[model samples]
Target: MGTGWKLYYTNDEYIDERSGRCPSTDEFMYYKRLDLCFNLNSPMTINFPVIKTFCSHMSAELIRIDSSDKQQFIEFITANETIERICIQGTDKIFPPNWTFDDGTLMTFFNEDEASAEPDGGKGNIEMYTGYKWHDISDVTLHPCLPICEII
Candidate 1:
């Protein structure tokens, strides 16, 4: 027989059974400066389509770094999770080399090291490298990227 322990999802309408109040998860963190609640879930194989679906289920979306401030914030988020890479919101699938967010917004900011010839064309999805630079990665090896979500 299977173990009878209960489990909770990161997006669940969480309530502490003991205190009867919502409690933050070990992976939860929020910043009032940006008013963004972050979920630093452990790394897992991630792709845009599936991630989009999951975000909708949680009323969230993959993080988007559209400015220097946001780029720094994302860096902070990754540091807290100690992850090497995390999925972000951008894609060149529709227009190679020109990335856009899912909402059809033009991605005005970039943290990629242009000198490195980064964005080597990996399935058109964007990710944040440990160095805080942008890179296009394909989930070919089941890229173990973090699920960095921002609640709306």
Candidate 2:
């Protein structure tokens, strides 16, 4: 069997050979001061902002966060320097937590089959059809209508 790794943080002492659990703000500060981070373990339980801040500073590409914490994750990506990609998985949609940011670009990924065409009038201005009903691309396939703009 393969060994499991973990990132730990607690407010008290870290016992045994298991990953160190940060229990206090001071201990977390120590992690933040490190230049390089190496992980050899799973199931890291961190309950402090400092540790999370350190993880963000270490260029961790894959991070798992609580669905309810999506906004915080978004904030971290925008403010922190170490992260390159933030993937939100195990969900049915991209904006499930319903986070929004103005004056910044957000890339939303979807399956090719799930893509739908917009009306000619709505070209260059695409709004997600959350409140209104939308038909599939087939609805306009037979009409030879050229969209107002092309998205390349």
Candidate 3:
């Protein structure tokens, strides 16, 4: 439990996040020591709220990479795949910004996009792109991103 990645308990088995082993599930695949189950449901989003609603309807939540291990796991999964970028849970919409996980865990993990200084202005949401580095863009931005979600 000291790994710090969020976990889930059920009639399912929990696998170590680093092992790259995931418990059996539906279309959503699990990853990391968090046993975080991810679903690439393909829901389009013009903003984070849209992604939030889509996840809520699925009884899941937006993807939140809270650790380097989780981030690397994501990169591993995306390697050789055709995904250009995926929207993740992170936003500076608030005065202080909240990159919190759905479980209300504050995000302490960071991987800059390096193309531009993130949060370029005052507000924006986060995205995982090239080399799986994190990028921040305006909330109003519209791009055909691979819709990704996490099931608790």
Candidate 4:
């Protein structure tokens, strides 16, 4: 809610100008250079279902940060006041702990803080929150965070 908290795309006109089509969902911003649409909702404690539904409706997937570009992306998101934590598309569902991006990008990058003991090998999906750190949390656990959606 501060000046630092800003949504890049505000209206259908802007979206049309940038991306040719207006997104069905209003809570997204279209990044011209990345050619990606991102949604960073208000700061609140929300569950996976809510985040999933929003991304599904927007025809987008959760944002995935590449390890090669982690620092740059972290700085970008953290600069926004309303976004402290965000739900990305990584989970430990598969054996041998395979983490992947929702958009099918190669999961070649990972930036887990060793101090946090991340990828805790816990049940459920992964969340990038708190000091831009990765944490494994249950899908149903309620936590204060924001959903980052990427146009699929």
Candidate 5:
């Protein structure tokens, strides 16, 4: 493999001492590629503990994802049933509590009330929203999956 791509396999490049965030494009690309090596049933975080830890910190907030890397992530999670829910979290004060898709799509999850809503009458059903929704809040196990897919 080329040295230019070495950063992906090497964990040394993702360390962020100050914020503890793995906000690197190279690191994202590495994970995007790593998806090719493992099944969705496998735990992706185990392969990159730094990023896994960083993302776990923000599972509740809507995420701000890199536009360049979002598609691959969406495709991976949607395709792999083993891998459940992905969310974006950030510490920046300016960031919103909720997140929008890089392409400007709105993604959300349904609360118990919304999940049980009936068709047509259940306007709150999150799955009925224009974009994607998680199986439920508890299923949101994957965090920042897209951040690791950013193209360097």
Candidate 6:
């Protein structure tokens, strides 16, 4: 049989893994091996600036794609869950044509979808919708997206 996984909120509250019910509060799923936390809730969408603010309140930042096995992580998240076009922390506003994470880390890893034309020199920040693809959307646009926050 396959291994079973348990879900927990940031506050250490337990959630029924099979139930697929998210905690009412801002919550994250803790990955023991990676020691990472990720949050993806539906029916709540916020813009880049607002997402940044929320992360700040939690003392976290939008998920960064700097891991060595980034593609695997992306695939895992996309295949197992139904996340709205959530916002990660990469923007090309500072250095034109160069995208960087919110923590000032250079974005050297990318997993754009094969069918998508990303970073089209568009306005606003970047978003992760449809699996591993990155799309440039307006900062003011209210999408059915969530902010994937990470402590580390």
lDDT of each: 0.68, 0.25, 0.66, 0.64, 0.31, 0.64
The deviation in Å at residue 107 for candidate 5 is 9.9
| lDDT score for candidate 6 against the true structure | 0.64
Provide the lowest-lDDT 10-residue window in model 6.
14-23
Q: Using lDDT as the measure, which candidate wins?
A: 1
The lDDT, on a scale of 0 to 1, for candidate 5 is 0.31
lDDT of 3 by residue, 39-150 (tens): 6655364577777887777667777777888787777766666757778887665434665555556778888866766534355577877667777766656576666777
What digit string (tens of lDDT, one per residue) describes model 6 on residues 1-152? Answer: 34797774453332212123322246666554455566654434657787777776766677786765654665576565566576767778777677777656678877665576776755747777775577877777756675667666
- How do the residues 18-86 of candidate 4 rate in per-residue lDDT, one tens digit apiece? 434436456565655445566666655657767777777777666677655544554575675665577
Q: Which residue pairs collide in model 4, if any?
A: none
Per-residue lDDT for 1-152 in model 2, tens only?
34797766764322221234332222221123212112211222222222234344543312222233433323432342332222221121234232221212242432222344422222111221222212222111122211111000
What is every candidate's alpha-carbon RMSD to the true fold? 9.4, 18.8, 9.7, 7.6, 11.7, 7.6
User: Which stretches of candidate 6 lie above 4 Å from their native place?
Assistant: 1-26, 78-83
Overlapping backbone residue pairs in candidate 6 total 0
lDDT tens string, model 1, 1-152? 35997775653323221121212543445565565565656677766678766666656788777789778877765676756777888887766667888777788888885867676674777887748788887643466687677665
Candidate 1 deviation (Cα RMSD): 9.4
Model 5, 88-107: lDDT tens digits are: 32221222333334333453
